[model samples]
Target: MMNGIEAVIFDLDGSLVDSMWIWKDIDIDYLGRFGLEPPPDLSREIEGKSFSETAAYFKERFSLPDSVEQIKADWNRMAWDKYMNEVPLKDGVGEYLDWCLSKNIRLGIATSNSRELVNSIARVHGLEHVFQCIMTSCDVGRGKPAPDIYLAVAGQLGIPPRACLVFEDIIPGILAGKAAGMKVCAVEDAYSLEQAEEKKALADYYISHFSEVLQG
Candidate 1:
């Protein structure tokens, strides 16, 4: 997959870390504060939206009394502990990162997660200095499926889009990387396992673990 790749970009939550499981619980608890339950399709409806966009969506869809910032703050507060204590890098991720570094391949992140949380993860994982560029979709005009954030990361890395390879865990994210004109690898995540076939079809490559990439 790295044949002509000068850089590798990753989506943060599910693609790079095993943290997708926390969001559903957070959504339930956050909405519970307003005596509301998340809609059945809530996750699907908000898939790939930036943190701010998701907050706005919650505010509008649930008729939430809290301002968008307030909702985000609540989520951040709820998620902080879980991320710090429960989340972990995906299987073989540490080795993969080291290998990439040894090969002098650039690394970057293009994510829909909040910057505060992303930074916290990097610091806790001792990856604060590993990535050449770390960016959130909030920095761009649009989120995943639009290619804006992916393109932004590539631009910051000084790598051409075609020379960058992206690892993503969701359909929208895979679409975003492809739309950016980069090769995309679909990563398996328990949260999105239901879409496995579609993911495999959409991405240029698919892997259940980062170790699979190393095998190539």
Candidate 2:
């Protein structure tokens, strides 16, 4: 049950929110601007990378002419509407957040998303104040699977890594939390259906929905 965990760290996209779908679309359209299509492994290729890192990957992979800032700006522009208006909290996440708040457990978000996109989602969902701290990959200067972002969030929350419990949907995110010496729960996301088993194996716990953790 991961007893003694004092704080819960969450990954925004695909974990607490259903925003993973938007990224693939963004990648496809972003590459199309260079008259190219998203590679079949595009999602895997950019997994665990920060916004700027992803942009750098795109530029070099496609031989694009735009600078990293230009590419990041373009992605932000393309993703703004969907993140603001369409993305919804993952099933049972709102209730889970309420549970955490009631229990006085600290909350922190360690995400690969840009600060703008994360803020937009948090604002729309009225979740801006629920967290004790919010940290982006940009803030850490590195992305998930590297442990930097997770460590940064833990540091901001003033919680020891072993006292933090992380919920993640992707392999990279799970790895990041574990690397930070935290207990990780791999949550289910249809977008990553193929990696469901792999995620289960890597995580300290596995649940199909946040509700399962609550129910227990």
Indicate which candidate wins on TM-score: 1
TM-score of 2: 0.98
Candidate 1 lDDT, 1-216, residue by residue in tens: 889999999999999999998999998888888888988899999999999999998888888888899888888999999999999999999999999899999999999999999999999999989999999999895888999999999999999999999999999999999999999999999999999999999999999999999899
lDDT (0-100) at residue 214 of candidate 1?
83
lDDT of each: 0.94, 0.90
lDDT of model 2 at position 60: 92
Model 1 has an lDDT value of: 0.94
Candidate 2 lDDT over residue span 117-205, tens digit each: 88888899998899989889989888889999998889989999999999999999999999999999999998989999899899989
State which candidate has the highest lDDT. Answer: 1
